[model samples]
Structure formats: structure tokens, C-alpha cells
Target: MTQTPDETASDAGSQLLDAALMHVPFDGWSDTAFRAAIEDTGIAPAVARGLFPRGAIDLAAAFHRRGDDAMVTALQQHDLSTMRFRDQVTLAVRLRLEAVEDKEAVRRGATLFALPMHAAEGARLVWGTADRIWTALGDTSRDINWYTKRATLSGVYSSTVLYWLGDDSLEHQATWAFLDRRIGDVMQIEKTKAQLRKAPGLSSVLKRADSLLSRVKAPKSKHSNLPGGWTVPR
Candidate 1:
């Protein structure tokens, strides 16, 4: 039986995700490899390739071009040399000691990072896009789950790149190791949550109270005071 467009897109997305993780740099941001990856799932290679580098600035623009799928394609088209990866990675890490400051490249890198594992390849291409945004902003550290998210995704991207560099395994043992660490962290979090759920009501309440107190003592919002003393516009 023939597959629906959605099915074809999903399969294509999975392949792209795998390819991204493998760090197989394409000849161009919108390279033939990316197109082939998606086309292999039955989508036309030309259609798949057209989804990338659309240059849309907003979600609406992205949606008009098929949303996340289009964005991922654009990401694949990202120009690392123009972004100055060689300079930024070195300067930020060496001189400024602030590697996270290169938010743009980091964001682009993140997008590439999540491409392979996107839930529906073309469906939520935004996942990869958002991953890049977060990484670029260096705000991943600001959230409690940032470490988990960044480490896992980074592992996937980095490990895959490592594999592509010289992987002999079916899917690359190094990549598997990276994924294993990420999965382990998630499992640990789940186990902790489960244990907390089984705790006595009073204990749970105390934990909740403590959490609330911590928030209360945390730093104030950066945008606490805006024009007219309103934090949010009406």
C-alpha cells in the first residue's frame, strides 16, 4: 500500500535525525544527503530539499512552507564558516572563558543536533530549531532541566559526529555510549520522581514547601519593571 504524505515525512525525518547525529557534514547546508535521507522514505527528493533554506523569520512563515520541516531544512543549510565556528569555539572557550556566548552558532548547532531524532521528522521540525535557539542563548543552564536536555542532545550530535569521523560499528558504539548516558539520566530522574510520589504526604508537602520557598528567594524577574510599571503589556 502507498504511504500518506505524513507517513513519508515522518520516515524522512527519522533518517535526517540519524544523519545529523552521525555528523555527516553535507556539501552545503541544503546538501543532497539531506534530500536523499528524506526521499528514501518515498518523499520526492526535490520536494524534501525545497523545504530547507526558505529564509522565513516567524513560525507563520515556517508553517506556510510546511513548518518545522522547512526550518530543519534551513538549519541543514546553516553556514558554519560564516558563523565563524572555528573562531568562536576557540575565542569563547579560550579568551572569554564563556563558550556559551556564541549563542547563534550554538543555536544552529542545536538545530542540527536534534534533526535526526525529531519526533516526526517533518512534523515538529521545530524541535531541532528550538534546540538550536536554546543552545545559542546559553540559557540552557538557567533551567533545572537544561543540563539534562543539553547533555542528551549534545551527546547525540557530538557522538554521531564522532562516529562519522571514524565509526566502524553498525550504528557507532560511541554514539550508543552517548545515548546511554542521556537515557540513564532520564531514567534516574523518573526513578526519583517515582520515589517521591511514594513518600508520606507530609514529606511530599515539605518538599513542595521547600521548592516554593526556594523560588520565592530566587532572583527577581529581569523585566519586573517596564514602561508604566507593568511587567506585561495589556
Candidate 2:
């Protein structure tokens, strides 16, 4: 039977994700061993290296320092010829940071990190694996709601990491909480903009304002008084 387009895409995506995760450092994996494993999985060594840019030590150090520059430098060391899906994601976050100020970079990084949660099926697997204890005790629900919950949680997790990237504060928890609040505010702003787009009078008000502003000043309609040196326009 012919596979559907979505099924084909998902299968390819899963393959890429498998290749990407072959060397997660937290699993006592060395970069050399991970590279070998990725090679064994049929992914080219160049591709694997590009996807997992930082060596275990560098990755750990960058995480400890919460340094965006370190992360970007690591990512930039790789060639794009063998770029994987996760590599694209990491690049996205890094580029976003380079494009903005530190504070805005945190926000951009958080949102950019969340993009993979929407695009990559592997994100659900990663979140589920990490939060298995919570999933085991939580009430079972429709797949949509389950996915929604997972994405929301993943978004929060991403935001926390982003906040840590630029956090100079003594307490990391406060930075994490600040990011959460900022995410909420960003969501509210998006919702408000969507609602305003749908509202009836919004376009009319904008158009009227534009029209009023568009008229010429007519040279200020110079006036001068009759005997008191003031005269009105003729």
C-alpha cells in the first residue's frame, strides 16, 4: 500500500530525530561514540557532527554558563551540508539571538525553541520520556489535549532555558519565572491582535485616521488681524 504524504513525512522526520538523538550527552554518551552510532544509523559523519555541534564537555560548560555566544559558536563550527532537523532548530535559536539584544534574544530564543515542538514529532517523545512520572499519574484524555499539554509544558521548558541563557541574577528560579510571565504576556498580546483583526470597527477606525492624516496642511492658512496687525484668509 502506498503511504500517505503525512505518513511519509513523519517517517522521514522520525529517522532524522533518531539520528539526532544518537548522542545525547546526558546518557553517558561521548561525542566520538555518538558520532559512530550516527554513522552506523546511515547518517553521514558530517551530518551527525552538524546536528550535534558541541562536544559533551563544551555542551555542559555552555549549559552551566547559560551563554548564547558559546552555543552559537558551537553551532557555527558545523557545515550545513549535513544539517539535520534539530540542527536547523538550533541554528534558528542562535540566529535569533544574534539578531536581537540580550533581553529580546531570550524571548526570541524561547519562541524559536518552541517551533520544533510544533514541527518535530520527536519533541512529544522527548517530553513524554522526561515527564513520564507525571504522565503516568495524570488522567488520560483525547490525543489533542494530551499533545496540547505536552507542547505547553515544552514551551515552558524552552523558555526556562532561554532565560538561563542570559540570566545574570544570583537566583535562576527568578529568571525562569520571569520568562514564564513574559510568555504569558506574549500570548495575550497575540490573542489581542487576533481579536482586533476580527473586530468590526477596527479597520474603519484605522482608515479614518489615515484619511484625516493624509490631508495637506494648506500652508497653515496664514491669517492677519485687520487693524491690530491680524488678517484672516480671503
Candidate 3:
């Protein structure tokens, strides 16, 4: 398939973002990473800034898009149609996060997005991810349900990302457990909505769809919270 101009641009941006990761923890998502990556890759500042106007946040967003792209590619190996909708969503979330090898990258990404001015941008990024996941899972929502589905999954994906950051349990066991719970909560809400389709209870369940998930603390395995070498807890 011939790639479009936008696809070409996106690939170039991802290459720059990958180079920037080495500097993310040190120089952060801002100028240092940007300059170093551009210098190394010879990407013009005008073009780089054009793609990532908000500096590090734009790089962070690119990193996030990379993850989403990876997740979609990985899902191609599985027949999502064979899985339950909830399971498909669960796998999508896991595969997306699995692309991040450096914990600090996520830590930095979270910090970049947590700024008050960027809150809406952060939400939009999550929504885009949810939309992609749903579309990849063969969702047919074309109405208000589209908004509601994305909104609900955003809660799940964002919360799971938070949990994953601190996960010290072997292979992110704690994080996956937290994700399962969140997915289950969504599943329950969906069930409730179906049952209440003809009643007035859907409003309440929809409201609850964005429920507050409790923070998941890292597991206290013998391995300890080593900063650089984060091994999957045995």
C-alpha cells in the first residue's frame, strides 16, 4: 500500500521521537531532547516545531501515538472477533503499554501531560487511543454511543497507565490486575446499561462509567524499587 503524505510525516516524526527518548529523562520533553534529536537526525527545527509545537508535550504525544500504532499492529496477530468485546479492550490496553520499555519515558510523559493547560490535550490523546482501540476491535458505534464508549475506555486506559507506572510485580502483574478490575467495572456497567435500556437507570450507569479507580501501589517483592534496572518481580 502506498503511504500518504500524512503517513510519511508521521513516520518521520516517530523517528525523531525515538531519538529524543534518550534525552527525555535528562533534558526532558523540551528543548534539549528536541535539539539533540534534530541535530542527530538532521530534522529542521521549523519542521520539528511544526509537528510538536508544545515542545516536550508534542514529543510525548508522538511517543503515545507510537504506542497506539504498536498496539494496533500487535492486535493484528489475534482475531479480536474471537474475543469478547471487553477482552479485546483489555488486550488493547495491555499491548499499548507493553511498547514502553523505559519507565521514565512514561513518567516523563505523564508529567508533561499533567500540566493544567495541557489537560484537554491529554484527554484528547486518550480519547484518540480509545477510538483506535474500539475501531480496531470492530466496534460499530456511530451515535452518541461512540462518545460514551471512548469516554468510558479513557478512564480505564488512563487509570491503567497510572497503575502501570508503579507496577513492580513480576511482569506488571499488579498493573494487569488493576486493569482487569477496571475492565470488569466497565463490563458490569455495560451489562447494567443493557438491562436498563428501557428504563431510566442508564443515566446513572453512564455517569458511573467514569468512576474513580483507586491508586494501585507497587508490590513489595524482595527486588526493591530499583530506579534503572526495573526487573519483572519474581
- Candidate closest to the true structure, highest TM-score: 3
Total clashes for model 3? 2
Lowest summed lDDT over 10 consecutive residues: which window, candidate 1? Answer: 90-99
TM-score of each: 0.28, 0.29, 0.77
lDDT of 2 by residue, 1-234 (tens): 999977764454345444433444234324554554556567665654454464433222222233433444554565755765333443434333333324432333234334553334334333532233223223253323344444554555455555666677764556645654755664676579678766798967756654544442212212533211222334
Q: Candidate 1, after superposition: displacement of residue 226 in Å?
A: 27
Over 90-157, each residue of candidate 1 has an lDDT whose tens digit, in order, gives 22212211212222323443354346543243323333433453444344243334434544444443
lDDT of 3 by residue, 123-179 (tens): 878988998898888776444455677889999999999989888899999998899
Better of 1 and 3 by TM-score: 3
* Candidates 2 and 3, the one with greater lDDT: 3
Residue 71 displacement (Å), model 2: 25
Task: State the local distance difference test value for candidate 1.
Answer: 0.40
lDDT (0 to 1) per candidate? 0.40, 0.44, 0.79
Q: State the number of backbone clashes in model 2.
A: 4
Ranking by TM-score: 3, 2, 1
Pitting candidate 1 against candidate 3, the one with the higher lDDT is: 3
Once superposed on the true structure, which residue ranges of model 3 sit more than 4 Å away at CA? Answer: 1-12, 197-234
TM-score of 2: 0.29
